[model samples]
Structure formats: C-alpha cells, structure tokens
Target: MARRRQAARAAPEPIRATSMWRVDQVFLTRKGQRVEVICSLVNDRSGLRNLSVIAPTEDPREAVRHAARFIAGKGNVSTARNARVRWTREQSTTLQDELVRDEQLEDDFQDEFEDMLAAVRDQMR
Candidate 1:
C-alpha cells in the first residue's frame, strides 16, 4: 500500500518539452520594403504564446518598434483569428534540429546546477 502511494505521489516528467519559440518564417516583403517579418510561438506555464508578423527593419528605430509591437501583439493576426499557426514542413524539420541543440544546452546547465548543489551540501556536511 505504501509503495503504491509513493509511486502515485511521484511527478511524471514531461514527455516532450521546448524552452523557446521556434521561428516559423522570416520574410522580407515588398509592402514593408525595409522590414523583415518574423513569426514564432512559445508554450510555457502561462500557456501557448503567439508572436506574429514582427516587422523588423535594418534601421535601428524601426527594429525597436518592430520588437515592441511583436512583444505587445500589434501584428498577432493568428491569435486574433483564434488559430494555432504552424510552420512549413521544411521549417518544422529545421526547428526540430534546433530544439535538439537547445535540449543539450539545457542538460548541460542542469548538470552544472547539480554539481553546485552537491558541493554546497558537502560543505554543510
């Protein structure tokens, strides 16, 4: 009975996890001639966050404006439309490769933290 209870109390790890948004598309459009649009989303504790149609320009001022708008939802058409947008098939594969690299970095950080914790505990002992 105690064993079963212990197992039940143990938290289940995430089957899949990503710590950052995957860049869906990067576009330099004619309408926004000097601007490049970036689209991406991140899923975290707050829920899935959507960033759409960020218009970045080579000019410093425009780039700042674009970043602010992107963060503040000025160009989030998909979220307003109530859609879950996805990247192209090719982009998805590329994002998967990037995610693998990110996972390795995350693991490395976790290992470092564990070592630091062990050293602290040793000092306490």
Candidate 2:
C-alpha cells in the first residue's frame, strides 16, 4: 500500500530530447484539420534540417489544421502563412525516418534541460 502511494506521488518525466523539434510551420485544410507540418531543426549544432509530416489519415488537410491549432495553443506559437509546403507521401516517409534517426543520437541537451527543470522543481519543494 505504501509503495503504491509513493509511486503515484512520483513526478512525471520531462519531455524527451527526441521530441524537441523546432517547428517551422503547420498547414491546415479549410475544414480545420492537420494535413501536414514542417519543422526546422539542428541535429548536431550544425546545419539546419527540415522534417516533413506524413500522418496517415482520411483527410490530411484537415489533420494539418487540427495539428496547427493544437501546437499554437499549447506552445503559444503560430505558423507562418506562406511557409506551408504540400507534402508528398515519399517525402513524408523520409522525414519520419530522419526524425527517428536523429532522435537516436545521444540526448545530451535533453538531459541538461531536464536536470535544470528538476532542480527548479526541487528548489520549490
């Protein structure tokens, strides 16, 4: 019983480094769905790279719109009107693979960021 309570009280983990992509833009359909999204990122503190979205859905455009609104509201960010790129299925697959590979790299930055956040939370406690 005590162990169960303790586990329940444990803090949630921080966002993983692999999930931290600097989003460049999000494109939506007129019906309000997230059709696609584009993200700009740096893998090794070097050149900028891009990620293309390839979510399987009935209506990609609508999906894109939904994603745009969700990200904007959650992160207090907005997508540029002119930056929306029409995504091909092949390109989307490639980008998805790239994102996976890039995230596989050692997550030093994420460790630092989470450590700082944990320190702050501990201080407040």
Candidate with top lDDT is: 2
Clashing pairs in 1: none
Task: Tell me the tens digit of each residue's lDDT in model 2 across 1-125.
Answer: 98999888969777555433344433222223333444444333244555444434536443444344334333322222233334444444575643332221113223333444455556659
lDDT of 1 by residue, 1-125 (tens): 98999888969877654453322222222233454333444443334444434344554234333533453333222221121222234434575643332233233323433454455556659
As a whole number from 0 to 100, the lDDT of residue 46 in candidate 2 is 41
Instruction: State in Å the error of residue 47, model 2.
Output: 9.7
lDDT for position 120 in model 2: 50
- Per-residue lDDT for 30 in model 2? 28
